[model samples]
Target: MAAKTDDSGPVLPPAIEYAWGLRDRPPKGPRPGMSVPAIVDAAVGVADADGLAAVSMSRVAKELGAATMALYRYVGSKDELLALMVDAGYGPSPGPPPPGTDWRAGLTRWAWAEHDVLRQRFWLLHVPITGPPITPQQLGWMEDGLRCLDGTALTEGEKMSTLLLLTGYVRNEATLASQIAEGSRATGAKPSEMMPAYGRLLAQLIDPARFPALQRVLAAGVLSQDDDPDDEFTFGLDRILDGVDALIGRRAAT
Candidate 1:
């Protein structure tokens, strides 16, 4: 048999090719001794322990016991490393919602799953969104969200808009929660203490005569920490879903 030969052209960027397992390997010699997985894991650890601000090439290199320059052979830059960390942290998507489940239930589960990821890796919220996500794991989450509305009587554009709305709501909620938690940590104040203090400050700042609705809300004790965070998330989600249901019903009636 003749020596085997394969001929295929390069198909992806060097970094992405390496990510997809298509990059060239060093000739049979001393191994490079570093792997992409190790680098990403170190970066994730840094972010988890000290927040995204602590993640840097030198820090990750130090974590891996490798020279800072050596990391560049595997990851092109800190941006590449951040991208890898994002994809690695995403891991895998949740299983599809039970068959025939209503869109609301399916979507609520989807949103909660996303919330769990954001909460666990709270640093991700600080990762400036460079652009629409292109990584496999991120796209998989998008697909999962779309799948939730698979049976709905919606056009493709409508499906996208609905998903975007839900995603925005979830992201905003998570961001707010993270801010509140950070504030609590910084000020050493419990939510119970903070809410009332904030309410008092607002009450002091706003004239009751000029803001009747705000005064009513303040008097109703809505600023108290009586409601669990889960209850608040469910309430907002239910209201959004109800609005969608009304729109769908009106469309069907027409």
Candidate 2:
């Protein structure tokens, strides 16, 4: 068969080239004993069972019944493997919204879909973001998010900024949920138990008369029980979308 060409030129990122089946297999080396899918699946399993800390190359190798160094034949480094693992976890872009859907609604659905993925694979929040995402799945999500604003009057820069803002909010919300779960696991105490102890510590450190605002927040029970996590996420997403809508309206008027 004739080698395929990406006639669009060097448009895709390097990692994406691998993802899109553009890279040819090495002709000289022994066939790789470990497949990329196997390695990624093993890594994900380890992470899901014991967290990301347990997903070392050696550990993954053991899971796959391969020699430790054999994994390197398929994946260049642990970092590269991690990138692939994240992309695998991301899966495919969701189906686009039906025609004439409002931009806000499209973006909201996109953000919530991403939030659901992160929530399910909570380790994703803890995976250190080393640099820009280069994986195909990640790029697919980026493309989908950008497409959400296609009918809007926003400039390319504005669209990009809005996507970044939404991504940051989703990541932050996921991190908060992960942290709360971790805290509960470590302390063996419910939020109610921990909240009172935290409040008492704060009371010892700050007099209510001196810090009225802080006092009021404490009294209002903001940090008491663990609030419904979904409610928290919805509240933040609504506020952000409201801000974006306000900006769009201003631009429309001017």
Candidate 3:
């Protein structure tokens, strides 16, 4: 589908146009086994099996048994393909919270849905964020997130900012979790073992006098072992929502 663009319309990349169904597919007889969605699916598969690093255009093309140049015919470039791959990888949003749900509960659900998606496809955390969400699926997620704040006293900008803040928190938490898990795999250390090992190492290196606060934490065995990932996730999510709750309360009062 060709994009609805006029003489003064904003220029979008070819892959993005295809994603929006705004760009036509190959005109040369449908290209028999090649399409934007096919190409993106292939790339996502490559990332899933290997990793984001394994998802080169040539690799995706090889998987499809098509020439590397053939991929370019559908997706303008590797960056374009990566963008499309991320859009497809997200699949779709969990959708807005059920009707009549409180805003906090809706946002809580939205945040968890995103957390679940990233955890399942941790490779997505590795993709560089060159810009904000604009692709179809990405925008859909954004819409759902924003919808959670609808009918609140907050203004549009505040709503957008709240989503941004919440999404950022979710991504940061997911990224850290992914890194720790990767570290465990690389070192052959189980999740439960790594934190305790680190605590021991810190206990040896840190002087109680020089690092009293850290020493107190160490003494309390706070890092005795890894915390349940879900527990950690819930704690952070609740705190962020608490701040949002306060903001909403203030807005409503005024």
Candidate 4:
């Protein structure tokens, strides 16, 4: 894998550099027992049990029963560790879209699969986007997403941009879903219970005269209703796909 770089070229962060095969494993550091994978896995374990905030080097070392310096043998910093953990969480791509699928169909599957991974590992949603996909699994996912646009009239740049757009949509949707899930867990209240309370708050706060569009939304009862997250996701995905199809059509026409 190609390493991440910049013109000024600060020392490459060890964890991501290792994943990109640009840096050596363990880097001649002490504690041969400490491996990058082990450190990342331990960090992930810490994050999983306590959340990303708890996944510091000290905490991860505590979880691994090693001194904090031992982890320094593997990961360069907590940010790199987080990058490794997030990419590890992805594991790998789910393989290419089904055979004979059109670009729309293929990209649709690609988007949904990406969405499902984020949903399953909701922690991935919380991982701050610091850089492009450099780790193996994330690169594979990027390739797979680009493959969905194979043979399309869209240029390579357009395919990459389309991926950025779709990825943003998936991440935003996953963030909302993850927040709802966390809220449910924290309050011990299902979304079905919580949304009504939420709607009522809006109802009390917004007068029809002051917020007619929002008031209309309240009157329609969609807010109070038990909305399926998947339905909302599908609606958004379809709209995006429609826009992409229009672009494809126009490109083909030209």
TM-score for each candidate, following the candidate numbering? 0.85, 0.84, 0.93, 0.87
- For all candidates in order, the CA lDDT equals 0.78, 0.80, 0.86, 0.83
What clash count goes with each model? 0, 0, 4, 0
Question: Lowest-scoring 10 consecutive residues by lDDT in candidate 2?
Answer: 25-34
lDDT of 4 by residue, 1-254 (tens): 23456887645666666777887555555665668888888877777777777778899888778899878767767777787898888888977777898888888888888888888778877788876667788989999889999888998999899999999999999998889888899999987788788899999899799899999989999788777889999999999999999998898899
Over the stretch 1-254, how does candidate 1's per-residue lDDT look in tens digits?
01123477423334555665556752121226687777889999999999999999999989988889888877777876777788777667776778888888988898889888887888888887666665667778888888887767777888788889998998888898899989999999986588778888888898889999999999898875446777889899999889878866776677
* Best-fitting candidate, scored by lDDT: 3
Could you give candidate 3's per-residue lDDT for residues 104-171 as a string of tens digits? Answer: 99999999999999998999998888776679989999999999998999999999999999999999
Residue 26 local lDDT, model 3 = 38
Best by TM-score: 3
Looking at candidate 3, the ten consecutive residues that score lowest on lDDT are: 22-31
Global CA lDDT of candidate 1, please? 0.78
Q: Provide the lDDT at 246 for model 2.
A: 90
Rank the models by lDDT, top first: 3, 4, 2, 1
